[model samples]
Target chain A: MTREEVAARVVGVTAQQFAMKTSDIKESDQFTVDLGADSLKSIELVAAYEEAFGLSVKEEEALKVQDVGGAIDFFFRLLQ
Target chain B: MKPYELQDVPTPNLLEDTFPYSLPPLIKFEGKIKETIDGKEVEFDPNEVRTRDIHITDTTFRDGQQARPPYKREHMVTLFEMMSRLGGPKGVIRQSEFFLYTKNDRDTIDACRALNLKYPEITGWIRANKGDFRLVKEMGLKETGMLTSSSDYHIFHKQKQTRKEAMQQYIEVVEAAFEAGVRPRCHLEDITRADLPGFVFPFVQKLERLSEQVPQHMKVKIRLCDTMGFGLSYPNAAEPRSIPKMIWRLRNECGVSADRLEWHGHNDFHKVHINGASSWIYGLNALNGTLFGFGERTGNPPLEGAVIEYVALKGGLNGVNLPVITEMAEYYERVIGTTLASNYPFVGKDFNTTRAGIHAGGLRKFEQIYNIFDTTALLNRPPRVAITDKSGTDGVALWVNDFLGLQGEERLTVMKVARIQRWVMDQYEKEGRMSSITDQEMEEQVKTCLPEYYQAHRKN
Candidate 1:
């Protein structure tokens, strides 16, 4: 998916998951800031990304991926 | 690699330092675990204790349909059966609480009345319209709820009526239902979302007066409907405590009762599960739910889940017959033609299933700890689990052998048995999809992971 699409998806997923307003999610907005994502949830999100997209994200490399764009880029690179 | 080696695996010290425990076979688990796979703790707040004399009537039928797969009539019957079976025979009538208020909906009400003729009392849901009351009358649905719009959105925008008009309308329709031999339970819809200071409280004040004028048996249920799933317990709501504190305040401050107060939540946000749970713990005896948690948009709290938790987990029933919930869900999903979100709470296809490495490892640890539910003082049930998620052929084979109790050879070849789920799951993660993975791809995963050295020990 495109980066913007990924961001939208992130916002959509986090909004529903966290009960936060979707508009509150911004590109620079840290997960802890806008979405109230806990440590467990952060890991769960990575698992979700893996499960949703069907790819392996090394637990080591997974931490470096931050924003929705980063996740999208990581996904595309792995895909290619 | 597993957290521990599969061979020479250290059996978990469950009861004492020396004893090893396996999962109990008699109990089927039905509660939310505060811990994640690796066993991080989650917090839960138990509300003030109150006598649970009132029964909750769930409307997943109306509110829960938006987000989920379709719920047909038979699905409704199955839910009724489950609700009854959860609480008891009396629980059946007290809990089989959904409504049909329109002539078009009479068939379902008639169906309920038919059920009631044999059993007496299947609760019904109703709109706040006068015409809706007529249908309740025709169906002879004695225990009926008549709902009227109280929120600005519903009154001004959807129903196009003024607050005063909605109140008057509520009075007119509820009175009509009472006159027609129906037990009147008025649902003040959108009470939370309503312009409360200006509209809701004043209307409620007058409703209390109207209620006093009627007989005490003429019940009025002020339904706190989070129509968009964003209710008073929401972060943006006038409060932040989800629905627990709200229900408590509504009961204590608003002068509503355990019997007359009903809480309805939507899952647009994920709080409905906690909200519904807290409402009961707080004070409201009647909590609403949908089957399979299916409903509009995100869906309602899975009624099966809430029932499971209430009876099987919190209240602790040793034999509540929850083993069939998954099977029932399978039947409903088929009729609805939508796969249950594997992650959907409780009865969802994968709720109890595990996949993550830590989770799988932990399952290998406490799969027996769940046996505690069956033996514990509070809860008792065998943990219900059937894993369809995992990674690596070894992991898959281990779980399969665990399921089949296979050991030592004579085990069916994984490669020849079917396909590779772990590799496919990994591929799915990496690429978002690998639709091209053929049956052969799965075969390779099984073959490479499982070799001739693997032996299933369970003897036929």
Candidate 2:
């Protein structure tokens, strides 16, 4: 999948997990600071991304993704 | 202040020398321990325990039975058989004393003897009466412990005899044991509360003299019974409560060898196990204890605790079968209808179970971080997580993985068990549940939430 498609999917999952709109979610928005996602929620978001993309990401590495842009880049690299 | 800096090495140092996961933590000692005895400084070499034949003797039938209802003939027989295995062929648990008074006790002894497994050679406990000598002779037992109360409290108030009179009466019983070809173990009842220089020393010296006349197998053994749990393991803690000075006086002054001396303690002050372990370091060979510390009053030093201490000091199992401890606990609960406290070390229901979220996280990452030793390999009990409101997603993952018997990369992650964790939280927050989530409830939740993993991994 293209980086645009991965970013769009990442934004869609984040918005759905936090009960926000896709328009409100930004690539630069931090998961914890801007989106109000707690530790468990961040884990849930990663799980959601794994399910949507049909890929298993290592927990330690996946949890390191801080912002929407990072999650997008992380899944893009895994998809390649 | 000493100059010190954090080296910050690339690798973490877990100090495997002290915390080897395969065995109980090693008990390393440095330098000599000195205590003032009768205005003179006496030194005790703590390192002597490494080579000494330090072992455990049991009073589970005599003292342990005193605290609880009597075990049936079958229960005693079963427990005795398990004790033989727990101690193993090396006989880390050397002898177990049984009451020879009752017909039931004698029958139980016979049943235990029928098993004929060596190690934990059976001995008898009797009152210091010349007539009791017949019981020892009749049972064909080689060694017997006789009550030789030493404290003025016991001598005057309890026994209603003067120190000299009590000592003479006890001597007659010891002489009878000698004539009957049985070695006498003088249980110095309440010695920690007795006047050491006044009565205990003189009496032990006389007994040592008497032992010299008998054959090597028939020599009198002295059991320093801290009956009131007044014994202290602290350095220079004053007599007759100081365990070090007491053992020193008996060994150095009274001429009793280390092998002939035993330490028996009570748990009134919660120092029974340590006091018994300290006696070995202070140079005694045997630590007399009861199973699970069950005895008169606050109980005796726990025999299982002493077993673990032996492994720690010896730095090896030495053929001790630790899994039998779990089996014994199960037998006690199932057959005997007894319940041990949930928090009791080694055998209790929740002994290794963690309820905290952070601890569960550490346990899931690497079990050794939260577990004491390798409980799975040693005691047949793996580290577990008890589900509660405080147990977060990590705890849920741990419970599920352990319940399903999953290992290695097959274990589920916290994210995978998040739905159950949310359910657990909802029980307390949304439903006002006050109790811990039971394993059955957790199992049902696992089936409902993680259906695929549960279906694939569940052991029928």
Candidate 3:
């Protein structure tokens, strides 16, 4: 869909994966540093996004996304 | 030192010259190996191995049985047949020696002889007694290895005879073997720790002299036994312990030809395999070994290792059948009820199994990264990923795809197997599991996560 739609869904998946409230999750938050996602958690977060968006993502490229905003941008391009 | 710069090429240089990936890495050599003996520098052409008929002889029944409970008669017969196939038509594995002490042993020899394979002509082992010649003559074995311990330790302490007495006693046995119309292979026990010039050389020279009087097939053969694993393969390593100088003296000084010479080693110092291989490069024709390095004490040089070494040196398998190594391992585990260490090279359960996530990733992209040569092609064992908490998604994907028999583009990716990977991690992370996930457990996960693929593939 749109970048805003992607960002909203990415933020929801990120919050659910980290066990944080959706309102507390920020666009600038880095997955590991700010949200406390480990390597496996980061992979789990990508899997969550794939399930929520109903689309497949390139594993290497998707895993490279560092933050909520980066995840949004990655999915936005894949969807286009 | 000369200045150097990196080429920084676009693609990786895989160095296929040494690591052809289809076979064991080739051992390329340059120039000659030189050693100082009696104030003279002697040069040995290491490259002679390529042209020489370097081969393996087995003592699995003789020395291999010494370390473990005696193998049943049927076990020996089955193993002998497998050994013949393992060494193949050219007889890379030439002769297998047996003990003639028991009726069962002689019966096993008779049974193996019935197979009538051309290579690994069944031979016998005995103490250096003229009396033992009766057993060899009775068995109809063309060649037999007789104990002729050479060191002062063996001569004075063990045999309780002076060097002259021991040498003369050994000569009498060789003469007896000739009279019996059997070739005698003199196993110079503890030669690595022996006084080579005084005892070993004089004795071998006498044996060589005696060999001249007999027909070519009946000539005496010499086995340099590093009985205590004291032999060193290093260049210029001193005296009796140096394999090169020891072999060099026997070949050049004592007038023993390479064909009639064999190197038998023990693994007391873990130098058995290398010392045996070094003897071949230093110009001996035969490496006497036992299966899986099972022999007296720390065992002998592993015959399977020697087979791989032979291929690497010759740069080809010649006539060797590599898959029989796996068969032998299975036979040892399943029939013989003995399990090799999981990490034993080439033939163990975990020999080609990778556990690291990064390694699994590399293996998924290119198998050569984590595997040594092509185990699938050579040993009938493909590279495997053992699933653990640290195995990550790549490991799960590899395991699942291998389980499902998927390949190339059809192979499931890490993302596709994310749910199974999560379950695998949760085994240790959530359930506090401490053991690796078993193949049976992984099969359950495949049936759960990818039921469609499982149903489609395993429907029959």
Tell me, by DockQ, which candidate is best.
Answer: 2
TM-score of every candidate relative to the true structure: 0.61, 0.98, 0.96
Q: What does candidate 2's lDDT look like per residue over B1-460, in tens digits?
A: 9999989999999999999999988999989998987788989999899899999999999999999999999999989999999999999999999999999999988999999989799999999999988888899999899999999999999999998899999999999988888999999999999999999999999999999898888889999999889999999998889999999888888999999999999998899999999999999999999999899999999999999999999999998999999999999999999999999999999999999999998999999999999999999999899999887788888899989988888787777877787788889989999999998999999899989988988878
Chain A TM-score of each candidate structure, as shown? 0.67, 0.97, 0.93
Docking class of 3: medium
Q: List the candidate 1 regions with Cα displacement exceeding 4 Å.
A: A1-80, B1-51, B65-72, B90-93, B97-104, B112-121, B213-215, B232-249, B318-320, B357-362, B365-394, B403-460
Which candidate, 1 or 3, has the higher DockQ? 3
lDDT of 1 by residue, B246-329 (tens): 554455456777777777777766777777766665567777777677666777777766655555223333334455555557
CA displacement after TM-score superposition, residue A36 of candidate 1 (Å): 45
Off by over 4 Å in 2: none
Error of 1 at A57 (Å): 36
RMSD of each: 18.3, 1.2, 1.8
Q: What is the lDDT of residue B42 in candidate 1?
A: 36
Could you tell which candidate, 1 or 2, scores higher by TM-score? 2
DockQ for model 1 equals 0.02
Q: Each predicted complex: what DockQ?
A: 0.02, 0.60, 0.51
